[model samples]
Each structure stands twice: as structure tokens, then as C-alpha cells.
Target: MVSLRKVPGAHQHPNLPGKVKVEEDVNSKAVPVDQETMPTIIQTVKEDLGELKKFYNITLSPTRFQKVEHYLEKKLEELSNITFGKLNQAGQVDYALLNNYLKSSLQRLRSDKVKDDEVLKLVGSFAFIIIELFEARQRIQKLDFQEVAALFTRADNSARDLKQAISSGIFRGKIERTIAYRTAYKLEELSSVLRDWHNFYLGYEPLYSWWVSQPYATFQENLSILIACIQTDLVGFDDSVKDPIIGEPIGRDGILADLDFEKIAYSPEELIHIGEMEYQWCEVEAKKASCEMGYGSDWRKALEHVKNMYVGPGQQIYGIHDLAIEATNYVKDHDLVTVPEIAETWRMLMISPERQKANPFFLGGNTMQVSYPTDKMSHEDKLMSMRGNSIPLSRSTVFHELIPGHHLQFHMIKRHRPYRRIFDTPFWMEGWALYWEFILWDKGFPGTPENRIGMLFWRMHRCARIIFSIKFHLGEMTPQECIDFLVDKVGHERATATGEVRRSFNGDYSPLYQAGYMLGALQLYALRAEVLQSGQMTEKEFHDKVLHENEMPIEVLRALVRNFPIDPDFRPSWKFYEKN
Candidate 1:
């Protein structure tokens, strides 16, 4: 889920990444965070993520003109005051984060050229509404269906009013049209969310008794009408359902460049050939590794042996925590990269059932969420989870998700130019973590042939992700075909393979995300070969510097790390992958 669970890649960093998070999240000076509100805060922010769904929704309309300018300014000034107020170092960081984020948001909102005002309005509204809803959900009597219906009724009326506003011809031009469209989109999205919650709560007798009464069209029905309006002739947007807000099909050259292969000078067809070759070569290596481990080239048996070591009698959680600690110690001993003091306090939590589908592996940054099955899972689910994540598999992931990976990235992002956290892509997020797998492989991290095979298994999976994602987006491969490719070519457990595909298309991930793991890592590997391998910088220096730079496209990252001449208006022209 590091990148794949993205939209849902499903992480809601309790600390998120940047300026606004600092202001809105850190609730108190003495306490730093209000315990009672923290869970609600985290969950609400995730729900607020809905505000980011439709890019057109960010555009504003003249009809929406309000006195919000003064309010935003006042709120920003108050946040700035918090930053200057006296507090402990931790509290100071939070205050500063909030102050900076609000300042940035305020500046953007004031820009009439950029409709960030509308963006903030909706985003802010979502933030407030989520908190209010969180509190309401807690107080509502479980059996009181009317109370739940009241929440829907409030949302429905907003929809009805907005529908009439658009139909009334208040929206005339592009800007006004965009504003109306976005408002409609948001209302529909929120309505859909409420409908899901209602269905979830309807199972209980208390709620069920109230549900049997009279009802009109559901919120979903109202949302459907609004959707038709915005998506159809009532109003239109540059973005379509196929073209997601953050995603655009970049075609072959773009894919190559993104993977740091702009200079490879190979045709897209050539790249496909190379990928197939790599896939085949890995198969040979996998069998060879199994043979060396006395499994007689049975790759499955070899992997199973390692898995059974961790899966214990009568169902235990395995040694995931111990393994992470061990990996942490290993990194500290090797000085692979700086694991700051902040990482010391980072906690490892089990993945929740609700999240496991999107994040079948793990999600980590400040906190490492292990993907092992909980006590609530069925035996079959537990078995598949165990087999898929066995010891060697987890070895790569633990290091990938914790130290030298997300946790370190998160720690550094907070310490560095926190504002830079705004620019996010899988290139840096998942790529950095994936790069370590390559780095560790080269340094002989997998001491035994069996270990090598396990590592190779993951390596193959990464490669396969690239090939399948490319093929799928190009209209050459279907999702089911992609799934078959993983299970067949990579030897992935069937259930686990399905989860990987699900993560790729989970409605929030970029089309290229599945491919990003290997491609991004390859780019970093190529960059290191250019500078670090040439003794321009030691491994420790290179890794540490990369982290402090925060996340961005690998091309831009290369420009920064290499000290390449970057004009004010910089563009990526570098091809770091020509060699490979």
C-alpha cells in the first residue's frame, strides 16, 4: 500500500505530510494532540480526502463570491500566531506546520487566477463536516433510524438547492460552470459516503427497526441525478471518469522517462522485450536458487520452507515486530541511511481488516502497519496471508516499509522543507523503498541461496508490475490478464496476486503505480551509478541527502541530487536509464 493503496494507496498519515496538517492536527500545547479527538481527526481527514476527487471541483464560480476572504485571512493569521506562541519543541513543530500550511493555502486561495479559494472552501467544509459527523455518529442512538435519516435529509436539501441553482442559469460561463459542477460533484460524493455508512449500520436490530418505515428516494438516487448533470451536457469538465484527477496516461516515452529511462533510446517495443527477458532470466535464477537450497529446483517448496519457519502452532502473530527490530539493528550497524531519533519512537501496528484489501502488503511512514492477519480473519485468509508474506517476503517489506524506507522518508519530510511534501509521486515514495531491495540484493543481504530466491521472487514481482501495468493501460492487457501474469510468471499466491491487481485499480492509484516500484528503483540505481558509484558521494551521504530532498519525480530528483543546472522553469530532459 505504500503507493498502490495511494488514494485508499489507503494511508492517512495521522501526521499527513505538510503545512496544513501541522496547523489543523496538533490540537494543544501541553498535550500536542487531543486524545479524544485524535481518532476522529484522523478518520475525518481520510473522509475529507473526498474533497480531492474531482479536479473540476477545485474551480470556483463568481456566483459563489463570499466574505470567506476575510475569514481565511483571519484563520491564517491566527495559525501564524500559534507558530510564534511559546511551547515545547514538539508543540512548536506542530504549530509551525499548521502555520505554514495555512499560510500557503491562504495565499493560493487569494489567487483569483487559481481557484484555490474554492478548493479550500470545500476542503475546509469537509474537514469541519467530517468532525461534526464523527461526533454525531457517536451520539446518535443506534436504534434511532430517524436520527440517521436526518443527517441524510440535511445532505439531500443541500443537493436540491444546488440542483436548482445550476438549473436556474446562475451558471453562465466556464468559471461559473466549473464551480457549479464541482459543488454538485462534492455533494454526490458525500451522499455516496453517507449511503455506504447507512447500509453498514442497517444490519443491527435497533437501526433495522427504524429502517422498515416510510422512505423516499435514497441519497444515492439524488446523487445519481447530480452525477448525470455534471458528467453530461448540464456541465462538462476537461477531466473524465477514464482520466482521473491525478492520473493521465503518459504513453510509452513518458513511461520510459518517468522510470528514468529517457535516454535509453529504446522504442517502447524494445522495452517490452527487455522486460520479458528480465522475467525469463528471473525464472532461471529462482529455480537455480531453489536447487542450491536442496529443493531440486522446486521454487514453491523452497519458499514454503521459509514460510513455515515463521508460521507457528495454534496461530500466533509471528515475529514481524522482532523481524523489524532486527532489520532496524542491521541498518544501524551498516549505516545504510540515517534512521533519526524520531524513528525510534515509531510504532508498528497490525493492518486493520477494513484496510487489508487495498494494502495487502504493508503501509508505513511514521508508523509501520504490518499486513499480517488479525485474530478475526478466517483460517483460509490467514493461510493465504501467511504463505504470501512468509519470512523472506517480509524481510524485504519490513526494511522497505520501516527504516530506510517510509518511516525515514516521513521523518525527513517533517524535518526538511516540509512544504515540499506537497509534491508526491510513486517515483520517490515507493521507488526509494524499492531501491533498497536492489541495494540490499547487491550487497549480499540475502546470505543464502534460499534467501536469494525469496528476494528474486519479489524482484520478479516488481518487474511484472511494470510490464502488466504498461500493457493494461496501452489496451494490450486486461486486469484479469494482469492477474494471471503475476500468478503464472511471478508465482504469486492466487489471493495475494488478486490483491496486487486490486491495489493497482483501487480508483486512487496512478495507472503506472504498479510499474513504479521497479522503474523508480531502477532510476535511483542508475543515478547512484552515475554519482555515488563514481565515488562522488559515499552510500551513506547519497542516501541521507536523497531523503532530505523529500519526494518528487525521479527526473527532478536527479536534477537536484546531481546539482544539474536547473532554470527557474525546469523540465525533465535527462535520460538516466540508457545504460540498462
Candidate 2:
């Protein structure tokens, strides 16, 4: 049966200063902010927005920028008329982000130097529709199939016309054309949601067929033809999307380039070798953990023992709240990074089963969702849900999902420039969490041999993820083969492995994301050797700088940290992993 889960507004991250609408009640506690001086600053921006207007001019040539300002300013005013007063701190941050978005459009237009007004206006429409779509969705209430489908269809067809313009114009080397493509990707996401709603409601939504006959029919036809053209012209059908780890297409050599591993770019075979090496190292550590647990030096036995402790007798014996508390103590005690005051107030909730098919593990952002099963399922699924999330296997990432991982990231990004959130990639989001595992393991955060095994298992899993995802993008592996590799090599439960692969291929994730965890960690680690290990900055100082810089590709980050000059023509030249 299709689960009746609907996509909510682009997840309103709990930690950020924002108003949220959730499927269930959330903490009513206001998101904390250091508003002492911010009110004055915000007021100043509100008064004239001189600072933003100055950037608008700087981004675009004085000659061409005036028209952009004239176009965008009118549209922003219309949106502000509708949703201005309702903004929470998070909402204010998004508003600032939208300002950056407008400025960026002009900057991109200037850089591309494309004088085609039609293309410029169409691309410009994407930025506005994106802002409006989020605002409209936030105003919606979850109810029946009829109301939900109606609400989203209106959102869809309205967006479809604006997006169809760039469907065929996405040529190679034109990076900004992806603005339209990514916007279309979001449209497809909504369409998929409606399709699922069509199935879940089972003819109850009267307009289901009605939509296909008129608006949706036209929208979808255009979408299909465009995607087919894009596939033939740009990225392939069964291949990854355009953006690689850094920010361009992941050509055969592009993955290494994106990861800053291009200076000595490894061949596919060598890349796979790195994964195998990590897997073997973890297996050896797992045996030691088994010995410490009195289970003998058999990895399978150690896994069995860990799995049993977590599942026990069909009920989850562990509480995620308790886990968060334990993680809080460990992170603070170690002083790896200062746990900010707002982090203590970050909340946790359970992920619904309908949502878990794509995310078998935990999902974290401003608010953290601890994964466990909630649906009516067979005995085997129940066991897989429990065993796959066994305490030892899950521990290394608990604090990672919360403290120094996403919640803190969400908090920092909002308070910092807020505009830089555009540069975020999975490399930074997922990589930082993975990097902490390295830091903890180095600092003896793993107390016993078993704890070490637990931590090392996650590291091995990240390495395997890079190998599988990159090969899939290179068109060398099938999804089934990816699943089998995870089950056989990473010791994932079969069902869990399937979910993992599904999430990777789904439109929600980019090609670089799965690789981002390990590859991104390596990027951060290499920089650490240059900075932290080299005594240019303490661990706290280095981490603080990264957090404040907000999330961007690591190559760009390296330049920022080193105070190297960059411009619109900035290319990935850091090559952090030259030797290995």
C-alpha cells in the first residue's frame, strides 16, 4: 500500500529561527537569537537596504544592473506584500537569501554576458517562482487528498510555464542554466508527490483524472520532452545530474576534481582500491571489538552481538533523547568544538515510517529525526529496522547528527551572512559529520575495542558509499549491484541497503552527495593538516572559522581560509589531495 505521507514545506529546520508547520506538534519554544544588535542592523536594512542595493550594483554592470534592479525590486515588493510580516528569524534569513539570489542572477547574467532578454527574463522568473512556491506551501494546511492535490497542482502548473523555457538551452559550460533545471527538479518532486497522492487516495480526489485531462497533461508533456532532450544533450538518463562535488558537471575526471583529488586523480580501479582498504581495516577492528565483548575475533559474531543488544525482543530498548544527552556530554567534554547555547535547545523527533523508505537512517537539519520503524510491517522488517540501527553501529553518528553536525550548522548559517547558504553542498553537510568520527577516533573517543569497532564501521561505510555512488554516476554499476555491494561488503541488512540505494538515485539527492561524506571529510582533513595540525589554528579555531564561513565547496573554502583571491572565474585549483 502506498503510504499517505505528503511533502511538507522544504523542511523548516527546527534550530533555525523560523516558523514551521509540521505533521505533528513541534516545540513551541522560540528559536533563540542574539538580537541585541541585530534589531538595529535589521532595521537599517529595512530602512533603505542600501547595503544590499550596493551589492546589486557591484554584482552586475552599472549599465545592465539598473534594469535587473527594476525587474526584481517590483517582484520582491509583490511577495513582501503577501508574506513579509510572517517571517520568523529563519524567514528573515531566507529573505536575505532571496536578496542574494536576485543579485546572483544579475551576476550570472553579467558573467555569461548573454544579452538574450528572453533567456534572462525566463531564468529570472525561476528565482521568483522558487521564492513564491515556498511561501505558498508554507501557507497550506494538511487535510484530505482533494485539498492537498488542488493546492499543489496550482503550484505546479503555475511553475511549469516559467521552467519550460530553459529546457533545451542548458549547454555545457553554462553553469547558471542549471538554475532552471534545478527548479524543474523541484517541480518534478511536487508532481511525484501528487502522483503518490493520486494512488494513496484511490480515486477519492475528483480532480485526479481532471488534472491529467487539462493542466497537468500539458505541463507533463512539456516536462517529458524537455527532460528527454536534456538527457540526450546534457546528462544521461541513468546517470547523475550536472553538479559534481565542487559545482560543475561530473565528467569522467570530474569526480576527482570536485573532491580536490584531481591533481593525482585516481582511476576507477584505484578509487575502488581505497574503499577495499578501508573495509578491510574496519573488519580487523571489528574483530578486536568482538574480543573485548567476549564474543571472539569473528566480525559477524560481533555484529550479531551488537544487533542483539539494540533490538533485544522486538522493541527498541534505546531512546534517542537519551542518546542525544549522552552525545551532548561527550562533545562538550572533548572540546572538539564549542557547543553553542542554542544547540542545547535543539529538539529531536521520530521519523514516520512512510518517510523512512528513502531515509533508512537518521535525518538531521535544524531539527533532528531519529529513525525507528512506525508502520505495520512483517517480522523481518521489524528486525531489520532495529538491527540496522543497532546502538554500536549508530553511536558514531549520534552527536554528528546533532551538536557539531547540522543543528549547529543551521544556527551558524542563519546568523552569519545567510546569503552564503546558496553555496551549500552535501560535501559540507554530510562531510562535517563524517569528519567528527575521524576526530573522535583520533582523540580516543572510542573507549573500548567495541566502541572503536562501532566508529570504524561507519568510516568504512562512508568509504564504500563514495565507491558505489561514483561508479553509478560513471555508468559502471546498476542500482541492484549497489545494493548488493552494501549488503555484502558493508554488512548492511538487505532491506536497509535497498533503501540506501533508492535515496541516492532519487531526485532529492545529487550525485556528489553520497560521495560527499567521505570525500568531503578527506577535503577537510587535508585542510586540517595545512591549518590545524600545522598549528595555524587550534581545533576549536579551525572549526569555528568553517562554521562561520557557512557551507560551500571545499576548494572555495580553502581559498577563503587561506585568504586567497577569488573572482567569478574562480576554478578549482586547490588540489588538496595531490599525493594520494
Candidate 3:
């Protein structure tokens, strides 16, 4: 489901010239380390380190890298205080100092000449290490919902800092700028929504307090700075630009100029109104549950009850779940021919609650376990309390997250040979899940009227998000307007809609949700056509190829595919893979 876009022109990494020669001479052979040879403990440690290294190399910006280093220093210091059998005082100090030196080395590279592409490549190589570190930190932290929420706030800040740094140093061309700008605007809407959400959180002071108590102070502080930088840059853009669809400045008049607007069955205003109502309905349901459960009830339990109430005995909800299961079964039935290694590796990856706490992005909601390939006895015992609840907007989300989504993606990455780093792109990761939702629906799995209604509702939600994101970023709407849009158009309740709007404002990156999903779907459709024309592979083959690559930006996927060697005798057909 990764969206593919060409970079337009080849651009070399800034530091490539100096390092290429040296790197070429250092080590070129793919290390062939046997997974079975190493002791279990050592192997686990090695894998963890590898994942951490990968993440650091790809995504670490100088500002964020420094933050991570500081965090590590603090953590090591904390460990020093705890009583442990593994190491003496001197050993602990040595460990801390070693980490200090490693961080310092990474810091020194901040100024080292390197091309953006090269940096991306380096990140890919060491992404596994970053993943491991992230997972490990979560496991050790045992973070709850409140703590996870705080981390998201911090993540937003880190993201801002990275974006600002990149923007200052690099001049993206007009096309790239336009794309980035539009995307940013969408994110702004999402942030506004999130802010509303924060306001709602404030209503429950105890929960809010618990969230603030997490180790996110630094993240929040840094985020504030990052937001300022973004705002400054955003203010410079001209807002009265002419619309492409209508040859006039984008405004109420411009929207009226489009012929399609009149032809469409639903008006924009109508859609927004629907969204608002749905949101309110959801809120009413939540409030009723809250009162029943008591004011200080466990948020997790409360959320589960709410989800179940929403799901009810509807075909739409149940059908999507069944479709998701079918998708998982298809993969299992074929042994995932295109990516068998990934299928094999699924049995080894464990989903720990601590890890979920550490990474807000991976938090499991309303599910006893969100995502785990191997259901060991331990996992089985820890049954998730949130199963068979309300249908999340993303249909593929259930399959991808719980059944085949995360688990399948992770296994593919682990087993990939000459592994192209695909896990580096969050956009594609989420997009894949969303894409699967529709894929199942299109396959006729969710055929009931209720399921259809649910699907339409979900679509409406996404559309509202897109519109909200665009209007807010373009300065066409206020935060309140964004809230109104969600509540009115998307069928969200007033309170819930308001919360979503606030979330958009405060979080600032929610637009990526729609952008990623839309982009992924577009690219997948295009790729299917390309493969058919070439007559080189079956649909199943292409699908396997796509999944095998795991989750990567569309552009990166295209590059890999363009360079991929396919059998000349292979005849492309959708039927290669089972439809159902």
C-alpha cells in the first residue's frame, strides 16, 4: 500500500563523495550470521541493538538525537540507583560512560557532510536498532494510557524540531513545497482537533494529572519550540493563491465554481453536518457509560464498554472483522509465497504492554492484545478486554493491527533478503492498514446494509478530516470551525468532534492519517496497472512483492520496484492470488 512518487531527479547525498570510497573498501559482503547459532539471550540482545541502530540512523535529527542521548543518560543514572544483581557499581558506571561516548560520536556526525539520501540509507541500515531500543524502553516503562498520551505530545515536538531543521537547511522545489505545504495544512487541522481532545481530557483532572506525571516534560518543552518555528514559517505563505479547479482565489465563491460540486449527491456542508452528529452520538454514548461506570472508573474499561456499545449486532461491524480474518487466512493459506520468510518470522515477535507504553504509536486500544505474531501461553493468559467492540474507522486496522497488519509487516521486514528498509515510513505503515480495510470491503465481505453504512460513515470521517486539514492549514477556518466541520459533517458528537478538532491543532500531524491512506490507495491502483501492462507478474505476485517490501514511502517503493528483476515468462493477473 505504499504510495510511489518519483523524486523528479537524481540527487546525491551531500556526504556521499567522501564516504563512498571508504565505505566501499570497508565491508561489502552481506553478513551471513545464522540466527540459530547464537544463544537465546545473546541473540535477543543483538537483535535489540540492531533495531535501535536502524532507527537512530534513519530518523534521528541532530536535535532529536541530542534529546535521545539526554534521555539515555538520565535513564542510566536512574538504573544506577536501583538495586540489581547483574552489575556492580563500577560496571554500571562503565555502561553509562560507554553509552555517553556512543552518543557523543553520534553528535559529532551532526556536522559531518552527508547527503539526505545517504542519511536515509544509513537510517535504514540501522533502523532495527532504533526499533529495538523503542521496544525495550516501552517494555521497561510499563506505560499506561495517560503516559502514552504524554509521549505523543513529546513525539509531536520531536517531529517539529526535525521538520524545522530540515526546512531551514534544504530548499524543496515548488512541487515538493506545494505537497509539503498541503500536507502540513492537513496536519494543522488534525492538531486543532487534538487540542479539542486535550480540552476534554482536562474535564477529567485526575486522568490529565496522571498523563502529565509521565516522563514527557522535556518532550513537551522541546515541542513548544518546534511549534513556534513551524508557525513562523507557515505565516510566510500567501493564502490568496488561485485554485486550480476554479480560476479564482480559493474561497466560498471558488467552491461554487466547480461543476462537480453541483453534481455530487452530497454537499460539503451536509457531509460536515453528518460528521458532527455522529461525533455527538458517540460522546453521548461515552458519557452514559461514564456515569454508569462511575466518574473515577478505569478509562481502559470504560473505553471497552463504549466500543462494544457502538459495535452492537451490526453486519457492517461484524463483516469487516470477517473480511480481516479472511485476509489473514489467505496469507496463511499460501504460506505467503512472495514473502515466506516474513510468514515464518511472525511466530517470534512478541507484543509487550511495556513496549506499547513506550511507543504511543503502537498502543493497543479495546483489544486485549493489539498486535503479536506469536501467541505464547503468556500472551493467551493476558487476554485483551476490548475485543468485538466498535469498528475503528480503518477496516484494515483490525486485520493489520490484530491479525496480519503489524505482525505481517514486521515478519516481512525481519525476513527480507537484500532488505530494502521499508519500515522507515509511518505514512505507508498506516496506509497499508487503511487500504486493507477498503480492500476487504471491495471484495464483498461487508455486504450488509449496516456494514455499508459503517463503510460510508468511515469514508465520511476521512473526507471531513481532509477538508478540515486543508481549511485550517490554508487559513480558511478557525479551530472552532474545524471542530464544527467534524461534528457537523462527520457525524461526530459535539464534545467528541470538538476533541478531535483540538487534537488536530495540538498534535499537528493528524492530517498524515488521511494523506497516507489516500496516497497509498492511489499508488497501489497505479502499480496494479503498471504490472498488468508489463505482463510480467500476477496480481498475487505483485501483492506479495509489495507486502514483502514491508512499509516504505511510495517513492522508495517505486524505486525498488523499477529496479526489481522480474521473470519475463511471468504473466501478470489478479487471479494469481485468491480474491476472497
**TM-score of candidate 3 on Cα atoms, chains taken together:** 0.39
Worst window of 10 by summed lDDT in candidate 1: 15-24
Q: Write the per-residue lDDT of candidate 1 for residues 495-548, one digit (tens) a residue.
A: 778778877864468656776687678789988888866787888898887887
Q: How many residue pairs clash (N, CA or C atoms closer than 3 angstroms) in each of the candidate models, in the order given?
A: 8, 1, 84
Return the lDDT, model 1, position 254: 46
Cα deviation at 523, candidate 1, in Å, is 1.1
lDDT of 3 by residue, 77-149 (tens): 4333433334343233223323333343343344222322333331222222222223323233222445345
Model 3 residue 374 lDDT?
24
Provide the overall lDDT of each model, using Cα atoms, as 2-decimal numbers. Answer: 0.59, 0.58, 0.41
lDDT of 2: 0.58
Best model per TM-score: 1
- lDDT at 26 for candidate 2? 20
